[model samples]
Structure formats: C-alpha cells, structure tokens
Target: MKKFFKLVGFASFIGILYYGFITYPKLDLISGFSAKSIASGHFIDHRSMEMIEKGDNDIKMIDLATNTIDENGQFATASVYGLKERKAIYREGLGATLIDADFDISAPYEVPKRTKLVSDKLFPYGNQEAKDTVFSSVDYAKLNAAVSNAFDSTDKKDKRTRSVIVIHKDRIIAEKYDTGFDKDSKILGWSMTKSITATIFGILEKQGKYDIYKPAPIVEWQKDKRKNITTNDLLHMNSGLEWEENYSTICDATKMLFQAENMGRVQLEKPSVFEPNTHWNYSSGTTNLLSYILRNQFKTHQEYLDFWYSALIDKIGMKSMVVETDMAGNFVGSSYSWATTRDWSKFGLLYLHKGNWNGEQLFDAGWAEYVAGPTKGSKGDYGAHFWLNAGGKFPDVPRDMFYCSGFQGQMVAIIPSMDLVIVRMGLKENPEFDFNGFLRGVIGSLKR
Candidate 1:
C-alpha cells in the first residue's frame, strides 16, 4: 500500500509540471504570439506558417454569429469590431482565448474596377536607355561613389540587405544586392502597403467606382451621424475614429491584426475619437478600413487581387508582390505585404517618373501631383499617401526628398532634386540615424 501511494504521487507531480510550464508556454506562444521579424512581419508567427505547410489545420475555429468559421469564431456576436479588452479563460491549455469569437455580417454588396490613368503617373517617366541618350551630358561614376559612401557611413542592423540600386537622371548607374537575395527574392514591405493602398484608391476614384469626396459608404455610418464623414477624411487620417495604434500592449492594432476576423470592420465599429478631418493622428485603423471597403466593392477577394496584379503590379514590371489577407477575407492593407528589394526600387522609379510606365500613362498626371502636393497638416510633406522629404515648417532636412517609410526600418526614399531613389529593409527598432546627414554625404560624394 505504501509503494502504491508513492507511485501515484510521483505521477501527479509530473503531470502538474508538464501542464504548468511546458504546455502552457507553448500554447501561449501560439495564441498570444507577437514578434516583428523579417519572416512574419508583425502578428503572424512561424508556427502558423508551419501549420499551413502541413495542410493548415491550426487556425480552425467556428463563427457562432453566422454559423461559420471563416467569418469569425463560434461565440461571435459581431463580425467586425475594434479591439476592446476581452476577458479570457483557458480551457485545457488552449491559452488566452476570447470570451466570444462570432459577429454579425451585413457584407457590402459592390464591385471594384480600374478607371482611367491619372496624368501625373508620368513623373520621373522615361526608360534608362532613353535617359542615357537625353542626359548624355551628365557623369554617373561620381554619383555611384557618393551613394555607396553614404550607405557605408550609416549603421546596419540586420545585414540582410542583399542589394542597393541608385537611380539618378532616370538611369540605373550603381546596383548591388547581398548574395542570397537577388532581384527575385520578394522582400517584405510592412507599412509601405499603406502607400500602395492609397494608390489603388486613386485608380478606383478615376474609374468612377468610388467617390472620395462624399461621406464614407459604410453601412454603420448610415445608422448614425458618422455618415457625414467623407472618404477623403479617411484617406488623410481625419476619420476622427478612436483607435489605439499601440503595439506593445494588446491595443487596437494588436487586436485587429491578431484577434479580429476583419480588420476594416473593427475600425468601423469604434466610436469617433475626434471630428473627421480636424486632426491627423496617424492610425493604421484608417488603412484597415480602406481594405474593408475594397473587399466589399469586389465580387471576391481574389478578384481584387487580380485587379491589382493586372492594373498595377504587372504594368510596373513588378514580379514580386505578395499581399496577405486576414481570415475574415480582408486584405491586410495597412501591413503584411512583401516585394523584392529591387521591386521596391522599381516602385520608387515609377513615382519618380510621375505615374507613367515605359511611356504608358498609368496614373492621372493631376493625381500624381496631388500625391506629391503639399497638405495642410503635414506642412509641405505627406501628400495623399506618400511622405514628402521636406523639412516642413521646422526644416529638419536640407533637400527636397520624399519617402514611403514602414515599421522596423523599411524605407523607400526618393530625392526628386537629385533624381535618386534609395531602398533599405531590415529588422531594427528606431535607431539613431541622421537621414538628412546621410543624404548630404551622398551628395558630397557625387557632386561635380
């Protein structure tokens, strides 16, 4: 009898140890995992990818509201809503699970289309061969040396930069990439997708598919006074919606990216933080809402995918552009888009030439100017979706340069005055680096 009791006690101890430490933490990593590495962008994890590789069984859940899993989860009462504090209860080591994971859905019934190309799409608009002929008057060797020296002076965090291409006067004079990542490896774009999403809106507007000037077409907006908010306000981040963009805690961005089924709907459900178009707080919620709008306007998510591929990506000669959508069938437009480093450079080139590609006017010329044009809030910077490389009222920078910047050091800087485009991507927090000083050095190395 003494031996039997001892054996039972030992077995119970081992069981408790396994459940408390190993299993609990592993489940935690799966359910509440958040890391921003080159591999998974922000909220996605390696385990999720592994599950997909092994036939995608890990992300299975049911939507109680719609009697479906694809819409949300089994206990969901709403389909699209913001990240409110949810009380969790772990069942058999499932880890911090939401109290309910279902939601109502009055999905928008519409279709997206590509309209006429804007005229400004032709800026920085010529081929390298044509440029060489036109600028036979300029020297390039000195220019390449300047760009190389500038990169050398700055600090590097990831060391994964496989290549750097410097385009001056519409020609590629200096180009270099790391050993493994040639022109083909599709690199991640992160928040750079915001700019791309904005561009798509431009296309949709020109086609008469959507109107930016009118109030937002959200169904909920019709139920409340929020209908007064215009699409223009949303694009400029003046939607006045209350959203916490914090990443460290399980804030709005975290919940939308990790917990919610549809990112756009989450923003729509949140109350107004301020009046629309009165102030700019820089919320990813705005972009997420745009993604939701886009999804609703298209017949299927795949149709929008095809539209972007044919209308923009393919025309720009971009071979690498992978956009990821959430389980709710909304594109993660504010984040989680990847393209090769060279492809990123190509986008810069496209912007530099306005919106024209190989003599084809892809964007309206006026719209291109509108994007690079000055805005009231950004102070000579941040036109439409692009960031103007200006010192603004404070004058932090010396020259006229603009860029499309993203989280953890993803940058695509375009200097119109110097006719240069610089692309950099890696995994690093906001380190101390003088972008203006770096530009000055590049100019110093190249100027005659």
Candidate 2:
C-alpha cells in the first residue's frame, strides 16, 4: 500500500509538469485556431461541417478538439480534451469574433451603409458577366492550360486550391474554383489581411490625414525606448518590437489573437529589442498596433469602424469582405478577413491600376511606389506591407514583382512589367506546388 501511494504521487507530479509546460499553450492554440476557424467557416463562408473539418480543422493538434456549434446562439466552441475552452461568436456584417466574458455579444453592432456601385457594365469592373474578347497577345490555349494545370497537382502537397483568378489589363483572363466553392464564395485570406490594412493607411496617406514617417502614436511608447519607432518601421516589419510568430504553438501572436481582450493593445507592452528600422522581424502584433493607432485617428469609435468599409473596401467593389474584429471590437488587422477570390483580385486590380478604379482615383500613385520599394533591412525581400521578388525569390519572375502573401499559399502576385495580377488561394504551400514554375507558365502564356 505504501509503494502504490508513492508511485501515484510521482505520476501526479509528472502530469502537473506536463500540463503546465506543454499542454496549456498547445491546447490554447488548438482550441483557439479551431474555434475561430469553425465559427468563420460556418457563418461567414457558409461551409458545411464536412468541408470545414476536412479543410481547416483537420490539422493534427486542432483535430484533437471537440467542437460544439450553437447555431441558434450563433457561436462555436472548441475544447481540447476538455482542458482549454475557446469560443467564437458570429455577428452580422462584422463576421466572426472570438469572445470571452469581457466581450459583449448582445451589444448593438452597426455596419456602414454601402454606396451603390455601377455594376451594369461587364466584369473586371462590374458584376455583369465578362465579355468574351480576344486579346492579340494572349495565347488562349496556353492560358487555359495553365489554369487547368493548377487544379490538378502532381505533387503530394494536396494543392487544395479553392480559387485562382488571372487579370491582365484590368480584365479577368482566366478564373477557376474547386468543388463546393464558386465565384461568390467568401474565402479567408489569412495574413493577406495585412496588405488590406496597409491599403487603408495608403488612402489616409493620400488624403494627408496620416503620415507614415511619423512615430507611431502609442501613448505608452511616448516616453520609452520605443518612442522613436515610426509607422514606416512597422509597415516594413522592422518596428523592432519583440515578437514570436510561431503558429504551431502558443506565442505572442496566438496569445494576442486568441487570449487577449484587446489585440491592438497587446504589442504596446512589448519592450523594445532593437532600434526602429534597424532589424527586420516579421510580426502580426505590429500590424494590430497600427490598427490601434488608426482607432485614435477619429473622434468617435463609430466613425473609425465605418471608415474601413466606406472609404476603401465597399468603396471599391469588395462587397463580400468581412474583416473580423477582436473581443474589444477593434479590427484584428493582423489577421481574420474574408473575401471572394475575385474581390481579392479586385484588390490586386486596384494596385495594378495604381489605385484608379476604372475612372475614379481612390488613392495617389505615390502610395504604389512606396509599397513596391524594398524595406531598408529586409534584404530586398519585403516592401511596405507587401512581399517583393526584388531578391529573386521567384527566379524567373520579374524583379519588380510584388505581392500580398498569406499562409498556405494564398498569393496575389502583381507584376507591373506584365500588366498582370494573379491571385492563387489554396490550402497547401511550396515544395509540392512549384510556385515559381506555376508563375512562369502563366506569365509565359501571356508574355509579349
């Protein structure tokens, strides 16, 4: 009897250590990512349980979670071994928000009224069907073959491409969607949302309402070592704020996105590690800080909330977009945004045409030039909130090529030399899909 009790005490000690060091953080990540993905997949994307499970939640750790969908209450909760509990609630016009006791689910949420767009014209700019027009430079068979080849992956990466759209000269030349997804299906762009937030800053910069060169207006940083950090530094991912972006485990990013009540304020507490613009470290937290700065730009919270939709997103034609906010009701600018592939292409189009939508100039041309230039310390691989090929990341692709890239191979490659914007959104990434070859094939099919 004495031996058995001693053995039990030893096992209990091991269990406590294991739960504290490993299970706590891992379970938070699994529960958090699963809960958010399930709620958004169900409510915003309108995906079925089978599709949601097969696509987003089927990952190893996240798969261990048991989810409960409360359709009537409009929330989804995920529990991993009944240890870590996470919940995400869906809101009309606001998409899905991960919630805790501090977040008021019953509070009144208001969405900006969308201005009517003239969609009587054909697509590429309107909702009408695209007119069939033969282009002198386009190789019809090659373009068709290129798009078709993407749907059938030869490698083991399980390409799971949901949608692909190729636009040249502001006209969609090729488009495709996988099973259970169509032209109107809203897709999560993941970290591609960073580019969208940067575009909002561009609009403000164009209007002279904001300046990227100035120091980030965080009240907490005003008297500290972080006081010198500029918006340009954050835009270029060189804000020098300490951050860890590991998605496979709980880190600053997952904690900010899932555990914190106010995500934008999370980075405000990080101690400065390097001087601004001196070291390039990618951080989702930095973007949320920028979102925090954006909130202070307007007098009322309602105006700031309405401006993202009215000024940029809805103002253009991305009617399908929903940028989910945190529990504190601030846009999770670092992540969580949904839009149809074509609407994502329209965003590429907005940049392709230098912020001009058909005839309307949404922002100044200088903003385009600013986003294309390589950041000071990014080894020519990054620009202002956009990824660049200046370092030949895609060897054959143009050095001037820049893009909005997200996890799991979501890309919006814009090549000024080719006058093209190629949007490829999928579930699997490189080492299997041959990203460079795919781009070469598409570009080769249209090269003059």
Candidate 3:
C-alpha cells in the first residue's frame, strides 16, 4: 500500500514538471516579445538589454536565452530555454509587431488613398527652440532646480528619470534627458495608450461614425447580457467583462498581448460577470475591445490609419508618434504607443487647448471636457481614459488637473489653470517619486 502511494506521488510530480515545461515557453515568448518590441520601437539596444534583465528578476518560472539583433540590425529575436523563439519587427509607420511561435502574421495594412504626407517642418517647440518672450514671466533658476530634483536618486528611492519636458503657455521652457536618451527617442507610453484610444473614439464621434451613449456594436454580445454594454460604459471601464489584468501570471492580459492572434476576439469571448455600468473594474480588455470597435468602423486598415494621422497626429505636429497593431492588425490600444517627449507634450497641449490646434478644431466641441470629466462609476478618480484629479486626490495639485498616466512612471500632466503641460518619462520599480510635490514645486516656481 505504501509503494502504491509513493507511485501516485511520483506520477503527480512528473505531471507538474511536464506542465511547467510546456508553459515556460509561453512565458518566455511573452518576455522576448516585450523586450524586442521596446528595442525595435525605441531604436535602443542597451535599454532592451536592461528590460530583459529586469524582466528576468521580476517574473518567475522562465529562462530567457540571449536576445540577438537581426541580420539587418533593425529588429530583434529571442528564445526561451533555447526553444520556442519569438521575433519583433518595426514597420515604417506602424510601431513594433511581435511574431510569436503560434501567431499568424497578417499582411501589412495598405496605405490610404488620401496619403497627403505632411512635411517634417521645424515648429516653435521643435528641437526645443522656444521664443525668449515665452520665458519672460518664468523663474529659470527655481524651475531648473525643480527639474533637477526629478532626476535625483536617494538611498530609499530611485527616480530613474529618462526625460522631462516642461511646456508653459504653449512654449518649451525646460527640457532634459538621460545620458543616452534625447528628444527623438521613441519612448513607449504603456497604458497611456488608452487616452489615445479614447481620443480616436472622440474623432469617430465627430465624423458620425460612432456614438458613446449607444450600445457597443459587438456581434457576439447581441444575444447575450453584454449587448446592454454601452460605449460609454466601456470607456468608463464598467463593461462588466470578466478579465484578469494580472501580468505576473499567464492571465488574460498576457494571452491577449503575446499568444492571441486576434486581441478583440479574445476579449469578446469573456463572459459578462456583472450588470453593465454597475461595477467599476480597470480592465485592459475593455480598451482592446474598444479598439476592435474602432477598427470595424472603417472599411479597411488603410482608411483607419489614414483617419488617425490626418485627423489627429499630423494636425497636432506629433510627427514621431507611432501606434502599433497586433498580429491580426488591430491596434493594441490598451498599451502600445511610442513618441518623443516633445510630441507627448504636444498631445497634452492639444487637450489643454480644448482639442483645438492652431485655431482648427480637430476634436468636437466639449470633447476634451468629456474626457477630463469624472466618471460617476470610478469614484471621481477616472474619466473616459484620462486619470482625473477630482475629489482632491492630489491635494497639492489643482483639483482640475488631469493626466495621461502609464506604467513605469510615465506621465503627461495637464494643468489648465496654470496653462502648463509637464511630461516626465521614466523606468522605475517601487517608485518613490512624489508627483503632487513635483507639480506643486513647478507651479510655485512660476513667476505669474
């Protein structure tokens, strides 16, 4: 009897080992794709290396082999436990696309017919060329010290600030970058892509292509309880979709990002866990689902891409911005966008100016207000996709300020009261940076 029990225990152990062997490849592929995408999108080698090392230390149950630059040196490929390799490549206009072991790489989106290429002309804020008159009311010494404090590291915390850009009254007053980074470096915005996605929805609404108050046009939901989910509910992150956003495990987020061919399909398959608009859960699945709806509105991928560029990025002078697509050609709108610090600041400026650029209204009237307005479901901490400062969440900062927040301490804060846009990008774990204090210091330094 004892021998029989021992045999059963040994068999269970073997099953566990086999399961680990099979699943480890998927985890490794996720890491490889993440590192390679950052490398190719940003055009940085050392940063990619640093990302891989950090990922290894962060996620358990995986072994990453050496990541190598492709023969052309424009892309990167990596393997897991010396098998099940994955590669990430950068397209010309689109950002990084990961090709994993099981992914069916789709044909590139066709270029649009109305491809009026905007010239990369030098603007006032381009290359940090600000007018002297713009700084006439500013305290240069105090502002410099405030910016310096953002980069300072202490024994208890690491700032790890890669770049900082301060725009006051539509002019770049101060700009700084780490040793290897510069104005042209394409830094990933992480979850801040959600704000860009929301902006796209606003544009579509202006063109009569979508309506936020109406029911979301998802075919699968037509016969189910999810059919009641409105576009506004999804934007407010009250979609009632059952999703696990955990990155530490092989959950919905990892599957949608690394394994799924169609991100939208994966999200749509989720069962409704609660009545729409009753509960508030921060789900990336809802954002990707929104991306799916946005894609289907246009006839083809070209029309979609063209609409985004002509309607938003080009008009705002965000020349370096790139929004990446998934394996199935759906924009990973929940998390993948890259742009320079200056370009990011320009995005903030657009919102600060109430969606008008140079006297032209790109977004509909009240669009910016709607985005910054607090969602009733989120307890006043969130808007459509933008994080709000309502309810005095940041006691030091103004109650009206709103911002695009992202993973790893990426922020593009907009203060309408101060006519200011502050951009800060960084990569840090266990961040000890005080955002409210930083904003207060910057505001206090102003000589207005």
Candidate 4:
C-alpha cells in the first residue's frame, strides 16, 4: 500500500511538470498580458492604483507586484516589470505589448494622438449645470431607489456593481457607483468591444471603403474554402471558423488575446468547420479577423487611428474611451476597450439615435436597423454584433432593445422604443445581478 501511494505521488509530480512546462505557458502569458495591460491602462488613464491592485485578485496566475511596474519605470526594461511567460513589454508610447513566446514577431506600434487626446469641452450631462434639467422629468424618489438597488450588494456575494448610469431622453436621469469607482473611472468592456468593431465597419461602409456582402479581403482565404465568407458572415459570427471560446482554459480566445502577436493572422488561419452563415457560434476570432480587415483598409496605422478618432470617438464625444491593440497593432476588437460609464452611455445613445449623434449620421443610413435586426442564424437573439432582446430572451424589456454585452457583467443596453439607455459595469465572475429586473425597475420609475 505504501508503494502504491508513492507511485501515485510520482505520477502526480510528472503530470504537474508536464502541465507547468507545456500546457500552462499560454495561460501564464494570458494572465501576465492582461495584468500588464490593465496596469498600464490604469496608470496612463490616471486611475487609482489601489483599485487596480484589487481588480487583479480575480485573475488567475497573476502576481500584481511582479507583473506590474511603476508607470515611469515600465519602459526601461524589455519585459513589463520583469514578468515571466515571455517578455510582456510596456512603453509609455505604445501601452502594453503582448510579445510572442518565441520573441520573433512584433508589429510596428505607435502612440497615436487620439490616445492622448482629451477634449476640454464640458460633458453635456453630469455637471452642476446639467443636473438641474437632467433629472427634472424623472421621478426623483423612484429613480433614486432604482439606482440605489443597482449599486446595493446587501445579500448577494457576487454582486459587485461598479457603475450604473441611466439616460432617459438623452439626459442623465440616474447614476450611481460603487465605493472605489466613479463616473470618470474607465472600465474594461471585454466582448462589448465587438459591437464597437461593428460600428467601425459600418462607418467604413458608409464611406464606400468596403462592402459586407462581398468576399472578405483576407489574403489567406483567397484560395481556400473560406474565400466565399463575406464580411457580413464575420460580423454575425457565422464565419464558420472553428474557435473554442473557452475562457477557463487556454483556448483560442486566450491564444488570440495573449499569445498571438498577430491576432488576425492566428484567427485567419482557422479552417472552416461549418458552412458560412449557416451556424451561429460566438467567436472572438471572427471579431479579431474583422479588425484586421479594417486595419488593411488603411495604408498606415496613423490613418486607421485618425479614422477611429474622427469617425466614431470624436463624433460621439467618447473622450475617455481607449481601445487597446495587440502586438500586431490591430485593435483587439474581441476584448480590451476601456470607457467611463458616461462614455458607454454615449455609445448606447448613438445606437438609440439610430447611429446618429446630434443630427449627424456617423454611419450609413439604416446601419443601426441592420445591426439591430435579428440574424436568421441567431434565431432573433443576436444581430450583427449586438445582442438582441428578441426571442423572449429579456421578456421584461422591449423587443426593440439591443445591447453591447461583455464578460463579467458589463452591459450597455439601448431601449429605442423607450428612448432609454442603461449602462452597467462590474467585475463579478459569477454575476448574481439581474439586468432584466434592473431595467424593468428603471423603466417603471420613469414618470412618462
């Protein structure tokens, strides 16, 4: 019996060694990459260091102190503060770099003016001047109660609501934040970045730069079976690419997010497992691929940066928004975008106004309708990139509602019928928060 136990222990040691040296390298890289990126973004955006440290508690395989360095000291070393799992470099000019494991490939990166641009213009709402008119029509008592409940964590262990903002008729009606967060805090919008990617595509389409119905301009698929796949298929997540979206393990999503220096190239190489536009599989790879295609539309990185700035961010006044790029310098549309709660609301407002901001059409005419319209592959639950409220998914909310949903309970729900936009951002692994019930409560509180 003692011999048997010793053998079992030896076997366990071998398994650990195999996983540590082989299977776990990607996972470790993902953790370090994410931690370094988050730390860099926070420091660059002037976020609280204490809050940033606390946020790292939920991530696996992360050593906050070792992985993160002071903002001034990050650029001096090849690795971001001497982190393991390859050299995750950080530079003041280029944010965090997800270096390849072999250290052979890294994209030419530049810090665009948009990254440092902050409009000095005052916000339309949330200031003392707008406060008087913003909540005048809202039921003060009921709206207050609803907003309070959204931020409350009385009996729920996983209900960490960071920020909640309710905009009614284009005015901020109610807003609340958790202890460590505020209106100015820029929160990460994981999968919600996909919707933003779709918007960028729509803007390009408006300018006649590309067409979704045509074959995607991916050189890899030019001679392959995937050559027939259209930009529309990628936007709808029906590109038929075989992608494992598992976040708990080191799957395609993690590989694209962390290990791959050229995320688009990694995803583009994926062979089709299903017929194009025939199946509805949520794929971060498709989004990243779309971002890559978008990048190709421009001759230089500066042109791409200028387009994003002048086209979307500047038009909607999303001044606090920051979209990060992979090592290949393509925006990681699948994940990695940060915006304040109000900035998220502005994004929702753009959708609520049918892709128009202040009477200027930011995208093609009827682009909003096309995006919110249900995809046949999704059975009315998902549109182009946004999640739809159709198919009885959110029975309490109007069927016309569409949302930008992200991992860990981030949402920017736009209810067009009600002229309402609700923004909720949080960091909960298993969310106990009820978005439907919360939206219902907020709608119920409206005086109209």
Alpha carbon lDDT of residue 166, candidate 1? Answer: 60
Worst 10 residues of 4 by lDDT: 75-84
- Tens digits of per-residue lDDT, candidate 3, 236-291, equal 88888898987766778877787677777777889999898778788787888888
Error of 4 at 105 (Å): 12
Query: C-alpha displacement of 2 in model 3, angstroms?
Result: 25
Model 1, range 15-78, lDDT digits (tens) per residue?
Answer: 8897555443233223433211212321122123232222112122211111111112211111
Against the unseen true structure, what C-alpha lDDT does each candidate score? 0.57, 0.85, 0.76, 0.75
Candidate 4 RMSD computed on C-alpha atoms after optimal superposition onto the true structure: 3.8
**Tens-digit per-residue lDDT, 1-448, candidate 2:** 9999999999999999987787666887788788899999999988876688888886877788888889999989998889888899888877888887566677877655555556787776777888877788999789888787777555333667878999988788888988778998998888899998898899998888998898888888888889899899989999888999998777899888878898988888898999888889989998898888898999977888888988888878788889888877788888888999988998988888889887888889888889999998888999988999999888978898999988888989999889999999888777566788888889999857
Badly placed stretches (over 4 Å) of model 2 are 1-21, 116-118, 153-157
Clashing pairs in 2: none
- Tell me model 2's lDDT, rounded to 2 decimals: 0.85
Q: Pick the candidate with the highest TM-score.
A: 2
* Per-model TM values vs. the true structure: 0.68, 0.93, 0.86, 0.87
Give lDDT for model 3: 0.76
Please state the error at residue 123 of candidate 2 in Å. Answer: 1.7
